[model samples]
Target: MWSFSTYKDKRYWILLITAIIILVLFAVFTPDYILEKTNFVPFSMLIFIVLFWSTYHLWKYFGDKKKRNNTDDSCDL
Candidate 1:
């Protein structure tokens, strides 16, 4: 059975995608004043946190996947 946690799950993907889109849109579409008026510093911080979380989960996900593959390979030996 597979269990979902704060990391390496749908939540992680959603946050990662959402943050990327937001950053892209912010840089391309939104104007500088909009961010300044809306408090871009805090918003950027939040996005960075999400990015960090996504990075952590991505590493963990790949690491666990590698471990599982190795174990499976060993079982075939």
Candidate 2:
């Protein structure tokens, strides 16, 4: 059976905490530098990570769509 387990999903919370910590650290210690280096390091990495995940999901979604379309076409024939 499928289920949601907090212990098994702890990484989600850990990632959230890590993101918060990184933001706080950047804000406190390197705000200007972060803003300046927005194209290179931490900020860019965050953006790239999000975009990469989004692209993966977009690819998966389109794959599902194509599969559904093929199934429907075959059924119609």
Candidate 3:
């Protein structure tokens, strides 16, 4: 039952697109000497993990804040 519509937030899409662009740019623009010295697989994996972790935490934090605001507004009535 998984579908693209499951993620309706524009912010989520923006983050995904930005991360992809960053990874692509990093691979293309980095100097050959630097790449030759390091294992690109591990480095790219680390970067991807960091990006996903930060994005998840940020989304959770903002989602909680939004829920709290809704509750507060309801209480005002």
Point to the candidate with the largest TM-score: 3
lDDT by residue (1-77, candidate 1, tens digit) is: 44666545665676678777877876788777777776776877787887777776777789789989999999884
List where candidate 2 sits over 4 angstroms from the true fold. 1-40
- Where is model 3 more than 4 Å wrong at Cα? 1-6
lDDT of 1 at 58: 79
lDDT of 3 by residue, 10-59 (tens): 76677878888988998899898877876876887788978776886688
Question: How far is 41's C-alpha from truth in model 1 (Å)?
Answer: 0.8
How would you order the candidates by TM-score, starting with the best?
3, 1, 2
Q: Against the hidden reference, what TM-scores do the models get?
A: 0.50, 0.48, 0.64
Q: Is candidate 1 or candidate 3 better by lDDT?
A: 3
Which prediction has more favorable TM-score, 2 or 3?
Answer: 3
lDDT of 2 by residue, 12-33 (tens): 4565566668767756786675
- Arranged by lDDT with the best first, the candidates are 3, 1, 2
Best-fitting candidate, measured by lDDT?
Answer: 3
